[model samples]
Target: MTHEVTDNRQNDSTLASSAFEHQMFKESTATRTSETEMDIRDRLTIKGGHVEGQEQVFTEGAMSLLELLCKQFASQVPQLLSNRVKKQALIDAGELPNFLPQTRAIRDGDWQIRGIPQDLTDRRVEITGPVERKMIINALNANVKVFMADFEDSLAPSWNKVVEGQINLRDAVRGEIEYTSPETGKHYRLNDSPAVLICRVRGLHLLEKHVEFDASSIPASLFDFALYFYNNYRQLLTKGSGPYFYLPKLESHEEARWWAKVFAFVEDRFCLQPGTIKCTCLIETLPAVFEMEEILYELRSNIVALNCGRWDYIFSYIKTLKNHPDRILPDRQAVTMDKSFLSAYSRLLVKTCHKRGALAMGGMAAFIPAKESEMNREVLEKVRRDKELEARNGHDGTWVAHPGLADTAMGIFNEYIGEDHVNQLHITRDVDAPIHARDLLLPCEGERSEAGMRVNIRIALQYIESWINGNGCVPIYGLMEDAATAEISRTSIWQWIKHEQKLSNGALVTNVLFKEMLVEELANVKLEVGAERFTHGSFTQAAVLLEKITTSDELVDFLTLPGYEMLTGQFG
Candidate 1:
């Protein structure tokens, strides 16, 4: 049933001469002038839903012309017909279905199913810490949706560390493992927790043998490495489900398609279903942006989510727009909330994913700190505002880097979930309080050199009192309604109280307890001096004693009393 075409003509002149004569015999059937030609619309015949002599006839005639053209071309390209016949025979025998059934649920829209497609929001944060059993348990207890056991960016790229990271992940996911600190040699046994475990394999483009790396031969492929990990750790996956992965630095739709095909092969070899292994594409490159729809479409719905990779996105933009002076973005540090182009692109991604009913998640808050110092608190405030904006614009979730930052991030989501506030208020006050000169009250110069410190201390104390009473809101220094500030104070106070309680109950205090106690003491005080004072070791011992005493309501009341100024001066 199959015949192969043989080209006997060796020279172009022989083929052109034979084909040229055949082309000359073709008829020109439309010599009639437009004025004398019959209108095809006038000769229409009703056949089913089609107009026979009108649209249908023209369409059928066009199809016939296409077939004739194809036949003529087939003579020149003989392999085309043979391939078509073979494909048709396979279809007729039911060897392949005409269409693949959609296994993953997706909202109806055009989507690229492959590559590192960007998240709906261009901001993403990832959390990375020592692979301890307690750290894993904390992540599970927290409200984070995508907990990535990072091996690429977070961990050191040493071979031994990589193997250790894999082992830690496998044990954590299986709920049957203990982790030992490589440095401290401390052991931690893990407990059952339900956090989703996602891992980032090494970057494909950075592999040793890739051309970009100037290698003589291709290094081991990240794709192969991922398969190796999955095969070895298959037993530890939830209910024997294969390990899930997030592919980083994917450049093209073809690359995504190739990975999808590779995954298909892996699944078949392991006797697993096509979608048993889920993937999240990290959209970090510019080319991936253009082909996003196609990439998502090709993946056929096994995608868990897309991440907005901030650091990589910025780096990629710099590289792509380097030659074009007009398109060059501002310095990375200068690229903040004011950038219109970044906002527009982010919104476009959100709209695209929402249209397809996929989760358009926000980016990470990686640089935010966990401590309760002024600078760290300010960073958390800004991060909360940014994440709230992302959620309002339709992101399903955002990332948190530190455990201390998790509560703050979650509080931002909880407050902004259904509320509509165009601009988030960093410090909100009662709406009924009209602005006045008194509202801007400033401390008289030299009246009390530490007046600002005193005000801060008062606000901190009020926060503790409200927390002790189980009230969500607390009045701070007669102004500024701050839920986040109150939360931080409460968490610090509780941490200190719990540690002290455990110590008094005859439990030995550990390094963690001592560290938290030190942090809590610092959080409760307001020093006028900066880091220089700490570096010089010149802090007054009285400040530490005062902080310890202020932990109780009676002490707070005494400090805030009308005559407390004399008491503080005497103590100093």
Candidate 2:
């Protein structure tokens, strides 16, 4: 049983009733909400998690499609999530991940993913941001090859944000998205030929509280994907493009197989072509890293590229290997791309993707150029170097958090890959990446610093305050930090404390030491943000939230889970 919240409690009244067009939900969604269909009659119900502000987005058509999906697929979630626990138990007992034996035949087999749309071929410099209306408009207008309307990490899944994002993407696909900032009065709109749109839905682990059936919440991944596909797929096809996606937080080949089934289901239901929807898989989790080739194999009809999600990769690394005392990671800053594990991972990605004739994308440079200054210049330079490394290592394209970074990154790739839309050079043909597991699993070693400790705590606390306050991507101390980076921050601290890590200054990471440092960092952060912002920022609640999640007896699978409960005030 999950905790549910309902409003109005008014009999025969519509969810979004006040002065709308014939009360859309009242006419359609309200009837379906409590109906007992033969397939899902006694199995589940939409009992809880009704979002208030944008209830009308759940119209008859959208909910009808959602209902069909829920009836067919919602019951399978527990089994899939359970597979994670069951697999982790094996890892807990000392089993490690490798290329799947069952999928070895598929790996050895020579098959390529279905041909992608022309616009999706050269994704050399894709800009990524949340699904806010202004971000949607600006990112598409930015001079990048692709703009991923991210509903996963960069956007907090507030009810309003989710529904509004659907409307925004609809408008974007129709070439009608525009925004005028209320404060600055600056207008935002798409260019004559905007960047290609790719939607990244929420991960498998998250559930949509606002939609439910069969006594369980609908998977947020499904809600985000289905709605966008239903609304915009046909229109995108008309414009010589199609619905593209970036899949996040996949943990295993088994999970990838499930996603393949999902794409199949949607295509079948919509009567679209065999491979209408193409996806780029994010290899962030440790298990996902091991199963990259297999993931592409499973979605051979749909997966177009593979990306190294560096920040979440770090978070997953810390969480996965926390039980092994010797494998405790160094400070986040010290773990550069040159670190054996990351190097192996990046090269392996290129190797795997190229060998199978797919694009191998690179990680992000989160440093933001918020203003024109010497500091901003240095930050852009760092971003250039980072993107250069990826290009030299044979990445087809890379991610830029800001539009300004697109040119530099695109230029470097263009130099290597030429005027070609996508990089045709598979430079790593002779290189067998991560020839051994140690190449991707080396124990990181370096002198840990109290400065590092303070920084992690500070970042985690700051990001959480914004996240719970309904901002997912926030500029703090220089760079754009999101849920992924914040996950790394808190998880690193948690792993450090659990392992009793020693700092360069000779202090041990004990409970008392952490508490004292947390207090000092909180005060310093307050002062940094100043009185007015700090008071409104939820610093007190942020501090408590971080402490609770990080210092818990067991590691939390995802920080957003607990953080979301706090945001919605609903939990099982």
Candidate 3:
């Protein structure tokens, strides 16, 4: 049974009624004095059950820090989320986002972000994965410059997973982390030299449902950032790296400003300098592309790079233009980064970041190596071409989902940025190729197909099933699919249905058509996974959810929102 903390505890009420009555409760709390402990415990409640090592990760000091973060910044998250809604309303009304006229002075002005840390300077190849113990060891030991330990898209936020991830990261930072295979008794540990570690927290819109303060759940970003920083900042600094982070799914400069403020607040709490906490923000949304300069400016003291999060950016494009009939996207496979909108977005990001002396990081290479020799070669070549384009286009580095692709990406980036140059900040495109608003919003050129639609349905169904079953990263059809890719898959179908798109087969997309396809695709998914695995999996629940979100009256903002609710069995 799921356990939860309740507000109506007799002791809780008694403590709130009188400080003297709380004196007894205070002594029972951990860390600091009774008065301080009471104050912290009274406001914050941990509803998550005790996972292994939870005591170490959720210490009283850490909980106090978490409480402080919630009190200080949780209120700001709602407004930022509201700001996103308002902007989307305008976009729905045809007021497409443009470069902010008010911030043009900042964009045109000559200023750069603070100097990046030496360890982060040559991030030619970075690998990312969920913070599972063995995966963390493998990723850190992978031959890459950096490893992004993801608690966002790549992680399913089961209480145990979240708690254990912190424990793994804590040990990883101290070089004490290891894992042994239960079946084979094979031990795994980090190599003598490991990649620089960076953490990716959840976006502003997510809530840590297991934690509550003032009768409301805490923002997952604050929850994640606060715990990780409190536990590891000193160790990281001692080891010549600070609390480096990757901020995900931000949609505006105002959201960037909020993160900047949070960084400042945490720094002040620890009496560290303002720039001690560095970050690389993902330019993954349509609106963020328009505010690249302003975002860099807001976090000028703390940011080092801006990444082109291609998959989420595609989802954002479809989402931002869901109501625009003329902007309905083609099949998921057709909307590659080479399209005008994505290309423009990437070019503008490189231009904006390079002008600000920040590393312009490229998007992910999500292809998983096929088992067959010939198919694996094809995968490598495709990744080679992708990284080659990014490198030639002025990106300093790129992301690979697997360790196998790291060397390929490294070779491409090394060829572009030779040994003399740590980054491509010297590469600028302002003079020759200027990007305009239309270029960023231009509709993708391709044809939709019934086959593509069926693929989307199958992928979304299986991915959502895996996610609700506590796995966020899955290899589906030779690609490492995460929340971002699944978002594109599902949202594209929703958009197609909303616009009644015509596939290449001359079949019109409708609710009926989607349902028919979904039923057929579910059978295909079952056969693909086999009867035993399909029976044990959450495909039934997944099918119900996929149907709900894809065939809803309006396009769902995020399928994970609903999926999270299912995971916790806590509905609004």
Candidate 4:
């Protein structure tokens, strides 16, 4: 049966409104610097000032692939994002998201994603971290089924970092990665064996200003994915782990369709088998949640798994429904996977994937076992229970934020899926996630406490400082935080303030109160990190930047958007 296409809302509304972004980013087929065997060079436009490692990053062939991908698909990014805004507008106007009337046919279409690769068949434990060399080495060596070397949320994309990350990934793929820790004087290298590697590029909404295609900045997703694939596809294939990916933040099946096309073209270009590339789509947004079957149907041939990105999913829930007074979330701590809405989403994910002959992966166990303290031990126990829930509910695997928690998650999966078996095809229990779209809008209830406010302020300040220092993932309050946690921390405070939310302590959360609390936390963070480090670090600017983004009249979608401009020294 042929599936009917019903993304008319896309064609009629948002796609038509994104002319400005497209006209600005038309692709150029010219040469930059010079072409050389030592380095692939080509013609390109650079709006941002020269990036230190840009030269090595844009080696001729790699840059060529990036240019081509942008030319073909970058024009479509703005519309996808705008579609999100339009849906948000509808939600604000009192219409909540439901399964698309047009796509119901597609959702019920008879199809399944191709079987996962052998190396990925048993992804019982996956570790994720930034693209920095030592972190990449550690993650790959962490004895998990897969290591997602991230160029997106877990990374602050400084020009040097972006290029250097590509180089590091190349080296890691060839088993030549080596790094010596500066502070500890400790050497880092891969273990005798490394986990299967999968790379997560930036979302479609992000832009790479350092490198322009025609006269405008290209989509960072294309830039990151193209560079990695152009440089290392063959190497990965030769090593028996085919080109694998974790596609993040897709809002619609149309976006998924675009990604599927790219995979097909790249496979043809490299003369690899048609389904050589595999992707695991992250259902992190409310809109994407409604389109799960359609998303998998769109990319069925090369898709292997679907993961529940719980934190960002929660943030997306808030962001998409910001204007609904009835939907304002409570404290971040109050929300957990066990909530009816999140649990419903999880069960639906497992049922959707398993029915389609694909793997339904679990969410991140962000609680890191830190310092062996009592609190840390308790968090570890919580992490163990979380993984067990996933295993019991038919999730094929789970993710851990730290290597220390790997064994804990791994043991749970082994109990259910067998030490030698993965893909969780044996679990045949019927999951009862009979959730409606409104249930996805779980009511936000709990004390908007002064304590919660303090936690937000302190974590945001520390996270931004780390981000400014080029570190995206940091352990704080026993949870492994990357850009997503930091975004949630700040945005929650902003949303709370916008609503003048009353705390459990009876104080109203206002802008005035938030700023006062922020100042105190900034000072506290400075004292905690010591005078010299704080003085030299990006603490002051980070504090200012954090305040500006959070307190503005407009709610920014991703903190990284503004933060990226600051990192590359660019502005509106």
Candidate 5:
């Protein structure tokens, strides 16, 4: 069956009333500077202002690809993003998301994805991190099946960091990537047989604030994707691999259709086959969960799997259902995969993907092993149980943040999916009572605690502080906290404040209560990190921003949106 790129939501009531337009970003702080590479194209301009290696990555050829991508598909992004607001408005009004009746035929139809590349079949233990040089060398050399070099959640997109990442990835692709630490003089390089490489671009909501087309900021996804694909596709193809990707934060199948169109356009431009550019979409948002089969059906030509981005899923649950007071979540710690809502999501995703003959990858194990042996054992055991749950529930693979946790995750998958099989595709979870909307939307049972609330405030403050200082992935309290997890932390506090939920200690979660805790937490964090580091760090601004968002009348869409505004002004 040949699947075509089509807009199936034309007559839908939830369509965004406004169309995307090209206009200068009023809030963008990027200033244009006269440089040699700046004259490459009149229509395309780089406003990032003089990085060391800007000339190498921003060549005319690369800029042309970025321009072409912006011209073709960037306009569609705003409308899709607007559709998210419209959908949330409906949920806020009264309606909750359910399976699309219009697309029931496609969901019930017999279909499978076109083909899977040989290199992508056995993705049992994948490690994901920022696109730093030493990280690229270390992750690729680690004993895992894949290393997803991320330009999204784990990366703080300073202009220099963004450009340098592309250069690092380019060299890594050619087996020439090397890093010598400035402080320690230790060198790093890729191993002979490195794990397969994949890139995760930023989401649709974010813009590459440093790049402009027709005086408007271009979609960061397009910028990241077009540059990487244009520069690396030929070399990758020659090496028997294709441009594999992990599409993040897709809320609907219409968004998936948009991506399929992009794949088709780029493949045709390069004279490659339809399935030459493959991707795995993360079912991170709550709306995407209901549209799993439709999403697979939309991108069947190029999609290989669907991953459970559990942290963001929880965050979305709070955001999408913010108006529904009855569904207010308790503690972030209490909302585990064993909860009804998360369990239903996992089982339904496994069933949907396996039914389509695609892989179902599990969520991340974000524990950073402690230095103490007993504490480290507890961390490994926690990760082991998590991976075992996914493996037994028919997940083909799982994610790990640290190299130390890969062995434990790999062992769990190996126990279920032994030497013979590449994945757990044979374990199709077909049961009598199929997973339904209520099952996926069931209210989680847990207790709200004063201690949990305090922890959330501290984590969010520290993570946001690190993020603005050009570090996105932070290890705080022994866990690798990324934007997704940090999002949950802050949003949970906002939700508690919004609903005035009562904690187990008999204290009401009022704005006054939150402010009290924020002050206490800031002092505690300052004491823990030392006065020298705390005084020089971005903690003050982080606290101020945290207080504003948590105490405001409405919850902010994303902390990164505001955090990015701060980051641009300080970009070096």
Candidate 6:
């Protein structure tokens, strides 16, 4: 049987208007049913407790049967069950009828197993911060839909910071926060606007070490902390009105289920309604990848969206593919959109989310242009193109490292989302066909040797130089394009920066700033390579070596773009 295509977009307005209507229907039905059941129970009680019975003899077997009948009748009405038991039953059944109160069924369509509104998809920007209060206020003012105050990877390993993060969350929810300017240090109370604040808690794997200061002991203290903060904050926040949380680094669907249970427990203790607290998981780890569908199913109603963790993903890939020398990532440039594995994984993620009727967001393209120059212009252009490609490839949204890049990202989204072929609807006869990533990489003939690395490096440097000079568009060899090429170039530069660069503080080059600093490094490499001579090499060999260096330079330029400045600001 063929399913009807009901335009979800058109139904959104009707759904909003019918919210109160649905509520009335449920309340009326529940009230009338309760009254009828109570009437029957009262009659039963009266009949069971007769005046003769009070005086003396009632048959024990008859009384037992009467009691049994009453119990059976009561059990038939689900509303008679304790809220906890009802909720548990619903969860076990992989449904969330109680949470919605309006939607009778858990599954909406083929894609969405949960009854959550796709309103999360309407939210454009996600602002993250190390400090909860500050980030929350900024996001609210910025009018971004999701504000993630991070306590995990962005924060350091300090007990005080953890306590502070929790306290800030409490304060923000209470609307008692005072925003202070970082530059002027002037403080003011913010009570008017509140964005949907979501906390990125420390990953479960790091809980033991973080709380106990030892890997062996599970951080039981931390669990208490979570319980206390979440319970109190849910109550305080709901006093006015606010959204839920964004859970990061979940390893399995069971973990998500556990979190949902934790949420329910906290909500019940705090007298908050079920589903008041919502969650979205970040698909960062390898385990999380395999369990994506199950996790989404488990958190059906409360789970809103999912994001890819690119850096962590890269780290995982390296660890997993360590045994294969051929798969070694020599430079960050080698890990471009061109990489077969990454592209394939991205496509799978997009398809999976869409299939489940959830928003599939692209990972961070941390291109922030530093300083107002031609290089910055080139960087922005490249970032715009990359974001466009992400949107075109079925991703609802993509991440940007910097706030300055936000406008460009939005603009790219607008330009592409409305285009004919870009947003064209495809009617498929079969629903099981697979979607693949678009072919973005060009064919290149080069030896997969150290010489190939050299060519990549040179290309990355040239791209960076063009970016810094304010060339909005640049041509490499005969290829004419905007910053997408520059971004690929920046990736190559990141590889060299990661391995070869040193900081003034003696810390390793890891952040976005270090990436931007690679332009100069690429130039230096170019000079060094010029002094060397290859006396006897074939045309293919020489071409291959040059391509490697050029690719490297292009990557460096990409990182140095203006869009990356926003990412640096996040860390700073």
Can you give the TM-score per candidate against the true fold? Answer: 0.49, 0.90, 0.93, 0.90, 0.93, 0.54
- True lDDT of residue 397, candidate 2: 88
Candidate 6: segments with Cα more than 4 A from true spot:
1-111, 117-121, 132-136, 181-183, 186-194, 208-243, 268-274, 416-572
How many clashes in each structure?
21, 4, 0, 7, 0, 61
Find the number of clashing residue pairs for candidate 5: 0
lDDT of all predictions: 0.43, 0.79, 0.87, 0.80, 0.87, 0.47
lDDT of 1 by residue, 1-572 (tens): 22121222223343334333333343244355343122322222211222212231234433232232222221222242244345435633434212122422222333433222222112233344434346666665555544666544443233333334445565566676565788999876643545556666655533212111111222223422442344333443324333567777665555666557656654453444345455767776544554454455555435655666654554444333322323333222344432554454455456545444344556656554634588777777877787777766555567776656777766666565534521222212223233222221111111111222233334444443332222223334322222223222222232233334233244433334434544554544434334554444312333333355434332121112222222223321
lDDT, residue 534, model 3: 96
Residues 250-309 of candidate 2: C-alpha lDDT, one tens digit per residue: 988778888888888877655555676789999999888888878887888888899999
- Candidate 4: count of backbone clashes, pairs at least 3 residues apart or interchain: 7
Candidate 4 displacement at residue 31 in angstroms: 19
Give residue 19's lDDT in candidate 6 (0 to 100): 36
Residue range 375-417, candidate 4, lDDT tens digits: 7778778998899888877999889888988888888888888
lDDT string for model 5 (1-572, tens) is: 33433223212111111110111131143366435325434778788878777666777667776877787899999999999999999999989889999998888777778757778989999999999999999999988999999999999898888998998888888889999999999989888999999999999999999998889999999999988886776567667676889999999999999999999988766545567788999999999999998999889888999999999999999998999988889899999999989999999999999888789999999999999999999999999889988998899999999999988998889889999998999988786368889888888978899999999999999999999999999999999999999999989988988888889989988989999999999999999999999999999999999999888888798899999989987884
Q: Give stretches of model 5 more than 4 Å off.
A: 1-41
> What is the Å distance of residue 166 in model 4 from its true position?
0.6
Is 3 or 6 the stronger prediction by lDDT? 3
Model 6, span 1-572: residue lDDT tens: 22232223223344333433444465466534344344444233221112221221123322232333333332322331233344334433443111132321222434354434434544445655555456556655553455666665444423334445556666666666667889999775654755456666655543222222111222322332353243344343324332456676565565676666666654453344455456678886544565566677677656766777655565444333222333335444346554655665566666666666566667765665557688778888877777766766666666654456777776766665554432211212124444322221112222233333344445545543333333323344323323334334334334434344333344444444443334444545445445342222122232332244333532222132232232222222
Residue 409, model 6, lDDT:
76
What's the residue-level lDDT of 375 in candidate 4?
77
Tens-place lDDT per residue, model 3, 1-572, is: 22121222123223224432233354466355556446656798888877868888887768888888787788888888998999899989988788899877787776778668778888999999999999999999998999999999999898778889999999999999999999999999989999999999999889989989998999999889988998887678666677899999989999999999988887765656557788999999999889998898888878999999999999999999889998888888888778878888888888888877789999999998999999999999999999998988899999999999988999888888997998898989868567899899999878899989999999999999999988999999999999999999989889988888899999999989999999999999999999999999899999999999988997889888989998877321
In model 5, the Cα lDDT at residue 385 comes to 88
